[model samples]
Target: MTDQAHHETTAPASVLIVDDSRVSGRKLAKAVTALGHRTELVSGGTEALGILGEMPFDIVLLDIVMPEMDGYAVLIAMKADVALREIPVIVVSSLDDEIESVARSIELGAEDFLPKNFEPAILRARMNASLARKRFRDRELDYLRDIDTLTEAAQVIEGGAFHPTELNLASVAARDDPLGRLAKIFRSLAEEIYDRERRADLTVRTLRGTLLVIAAGSIFGIAPALGRLASAREIPPLGLAFWSAVVAAILCLSFSIGRSGLPRLKLRDLRFLTLWALLLGCLYQLLTVVIAAHVEASLIAMIGSSRGFMVFLLAALLALERPSLQRFSGLGLGFAAVAVVLLVQGTGEDNDLLWIACALVLPFLLSLHTLLMSWRPRHLGAATTVGIMMALSALFLLPFAVAQNALFLPSLSFGQRELITLALGASTAAALVLALDLVVTAGPVFSSQMAYSQTLAGIAWGMLLLGERLSPLAWGALVFVIAGFWLVKPKRAGDDFRITLRMKGNG
Candidate 1:
């Protein structure tokens, strides 16, 4: 225990003397002070009450017969106030009025009665006993308060979401007692559980991130085919982009509102949101729609798959990620698979250098979008953030679509065009929201690994929906994507598979 606390527990008692007679008051003050206690003197009940109101005293020596507000009135008033009622009060009276005074004082809630000419020894015994009781009561109150704190700490443990410092048991743990020892043990256990929970959470988050990446990749893979179909109907790039963004915005906003309430955009977030919309909604969408019109869907997917490599390179250059040989090799293999699919499996116009160059730009924009999402405001939820971005994109595209006179509005009827349009918008909303979530739950590089799944899903969807064909060499290249995906996936902390493999070889 600290010296201050020890001193407080064993401190001298403060006694208040309230008497009409100045001589008797002074006498009692001298006697009390001589017993190593602190004493305050007041000539009447009103003055005594005023002094008591200002400060605390261990005991009060109140004279029965005071001029105004006698000791009985003072006792009744003190007992009425919860703050003063607990203080020990002793009423003083001379022999003549001792019986009546003592009976009335006890009825008025005084602790005991004292003779006006009481001996110093008797005064010491009575005052010392009262002081001891007051101190014991104080300690009991403190112990109960600490116990309540421990109960709160127990509830926090049961809640399963807390930091070690959040237990708030420092004061109780500081005491040199059995309860203090229990607090120390409980704190240590809480810390251990916190550490274990973190490790478990890390593993769960990694798995969830992987699932999000795959879901986003599969949804995004359908976009190229949709764009090609829209192109066949002579849809303008800006018109297609604008309509798709509007649909996505509507769907995302509804879900966001229902799930997390409407997004409140800050002035600082507007700049980031605007830029995000421009890249993903305006520029990227325009390029994607234009290239999808000319390029084969599978080849588009192959070129888009290079986004992972771009993100890896950019992240390394920006010092946002440490370059690892294992990760580099895995991404290299994925990139090589994309190259093989592009070069070995080609149809008419697939060899157009201009369209291919434009297609490659898609991955660079996607890489930048991935990194930007990582740096997004921490407060924005995935659905709300994506909803806001899509909404802004629709706003930005409206003027351009109008100026180009290429605004494509689907009919209210459930026609083929409307169905495709709805599908396109719904897929875009799901993909974008999940992508942002993956970025938050995992590192950007791991999130970018979705490119491998996107390539595979795109090719499969092309074959199933568009009657596209892939050669034997293209099929073999897909194996590389799968292998690379496994290599680049997140591992538990302190796990290094490459080192494990090397050690096994040496053994």
Candidate 2:
């Protein structure tokens, strides 16, 4: 490798190394300094944050499991800052293989991750890579900012006359090959159209698949509830409540399938995720079957659905996409409010425990689904892959449904039949609403705001149609959820709150 000092020193890149280990910090500092770059060593994230406030650094080397403020908290703080958010952070920690932790770091806007035990060469390489990436990103930003100027200059002479005429005359005088020029123009146009069409097709397929998965999964969740309602021959007091856990699970799965395809298999690209999905899918089915044999169907369904959330969380962690804490917190708050409403209204002894279990598992499954969808293979059509996966899941569940006689068709009066069908239809319809909502509010809007809106809508609908009452706890939960989401709103320069990084670095 070339000496760091030998590289151009027009603007010496700055690096801050934050670690609890004095030895590691000093070593990293030395390595960075050797490259003719300015380096600072801080013992912990708090110190690093303090330094960040005083001086701007081009990159940060963070340790994951630090004292007081861990790498995650620090990264979050950095991203929250307008000045620091632009600086690329490389996580240097021992928790390299800890997939969840790594994924969380990435989600928190960390640019890269590295292990503490990395070889000197690897360390040097990583540092250089980080700096290079930052430079490229800066260059792209600058280019975009001055694109009009660049375009105008390229097209016009100093006096603002078109340069194309002069270039054409010169080309003619030189007798340049016309066929070669025509071929180049045709090739460029074809390539552009091909790229646009490919993107459009992928988007269309992903959306269609997302809708189908939600519909199918909802049918799976609601079918059992409908059967039970028919068996009991009573108006299910908690129609939405009974279906909530299942709806949540189907929603999480739909989100995952929509964001990522069901049949998405990338052995070389996040193999851990593929393994996790396969393992979780099996575990979920096994657990559902075992639990169904011993427990009430509703309880089994609730617990099973909750477990699916946990799987979703694992998937998100593995995918390395940052969880919108605001969004998650909002979801949590909304659930809490719903819980309060249920408790005030619920008469059953076992209902609370089942609900709690379902709530606990919801975030994990949601995260998992989000992560899986984010990394869906470009080659596979999203709708087709999702359809296949849902079909497979149905096939897998068929045996359990059959053995338990959960497959029994219920004879019903007109109203009961209508309720059952509505429940089934609602699940699918809700999934479509969710996908549309995601597309609409993806950037800038506080997760809490979205949650608050959803909570209000649910409460309003319940009150108007079902005559359901919201207790004080529901209101309290709503307040907390909204407040949390507002607090996490991204602090950036522009009004646009989208968190996209410069893609040109990899290019």
Candidate 3:
């Protein structure tokens, strides 16, 4: 009681302290009040929720190991509620080594976690930090709101004055002199909107490329680690499960593509389209899996090879369309970068030459698919295209999968492993292919740029997670890829000539 009285004398702050024990709750309330903060004491999560509804509080001090309504449940409820979600929650628990509890609390949107027996100073510091974060979030939200308002106003102005046809004609007749000025203003507003939209589109494109690259890199890194786990029998069920997942993912991707509604294909589609192109895109993964099963080529290398082919095909297709020097340079740099990485990190003893050959051939097939998809105006939507392709690919590969005994669904002793594998394969792979299809459909340059990004991401993920080392040559390769991508950025005529002159001057 004396300790509580001594503490209630700082700048007034509102805190809701929740604990099952009445004595402990009172102790916390008194201590919090001593720090010049008003404290609300609640016995459990249910009461805390009720109190939260009655009035706003600065922070909630939650107890993790509670009764019916545990701290986790309370935290989740808080996060789910738009009105209560922003309130800072500090979890005060007796359990010192509750890593899962702490992780879960944080994930459920808890602001901070503190040991129940923490020092007064530590408690104060944690509270302050949480409050600071809340303030920062508030400011960010405010900024976003203001920006949204401005964007809306700009859009409305750009959209022009809304008038009925009858009124519009009357106004035009009455205000002939002002009509030109109005038109000019409207045009200016429209131009600004267009510029803003274009910038946004470019940013989205760049972000999409970055995300895909990261995903590809991550998948590559995971493949080797998962393979190693499988070999060790540490997670054989998981490995087998992942194999199933990969098949399912391929099937989903095939479905997406077939349903994508590509322009009506005629006999002429085959003339322009080589079987190699389809094989390249489609068979690479099949080859990758076979090699991964009995070879030493790193997953990263395979992913890079696939990406390289995809980019090469895109560049070639683009060059065919536009016949640009820049496009050719991008293609060369992309391949050279891939080569450098491969050369520096020589193939492992387990790496079969045939497998590598198969992997190399894969991109051509993928490129063919991309090129055909991009050849004309899309007849099918993105979702349909991805679905159809995935479905078709699955059908085409079904016989092979069946023959190899890889498609068997044995009774699982490990449901969790099976689910994880399914999620990784179906969700992750399907999402990636869908995104890639969208990027490729947008433009060849966009697709190629994404490949470079993916390679870098893969390298990063490998180094961080899988203890994969990048050689000096590999580093150089990365630099070349980045530089090449920059060099290939679309330029106006004046900029192109200027760049050419500078190159000549350097030479």
Highest TM-score among the candidates is held by which one? 1
Tens digit per residue, CA lDDT, model 3, 183-272: 445445545545555555555555555455445444533443334334444334323443544455456546655655344545544433
Query: How many residue pairs clash in each candidate at the backbone level?
Result: 0, 12, 41
lDDT of the candidates, in the order given:
0.81, 0.50, 0.56
TM-scores, all candidates, are 0.64, 0.34, 0.44
Model 2 Cα shift for residue 481 (angstroms): 3.1
- Over 4 Å off, model 3: 1-200, 220-282, 299-323, 327-338, 352-354, 372-388, 403-406, 415-424, 427-434, 437-442, 456-469, 472-507
If the candidates were sorted by their lDDT against the true structure, best first, what order would they fall in?
A: 1, 3, 2
Give the top-scoring candidate (lDDT): 1
Model with the higher TM-score, candidate 2 or 3: 3
Across residues 1-507, which tens digit of lDDT does each residue of candidate 1 receive?
567555544479888999989899898899888888888999998998999999988889999888978888999999999999989898888849578778888998888878987988788778766776777788888999899999998877665446667779999899899999999999888777666766776677667876887789989888888877777777788877888888898988899899888677789999999999999988887777788888877778888888998899998898877778888888889788777776777645554778877788888898999999877877888778888898899899999999999887778776766766777788889999889888767678877878877877788777877888887676787678667755676534332111111223334
What's the residue-level lDDT of 49 in candidate 3? 98
Model 3 worst lDDT run, 10 consecutive residues: 492-501
Q: Return the TM-score for candidate 1, rounded to 2 decimals.
A: 0.64
Which lDDT value does model 2 have at 369?
A: 42
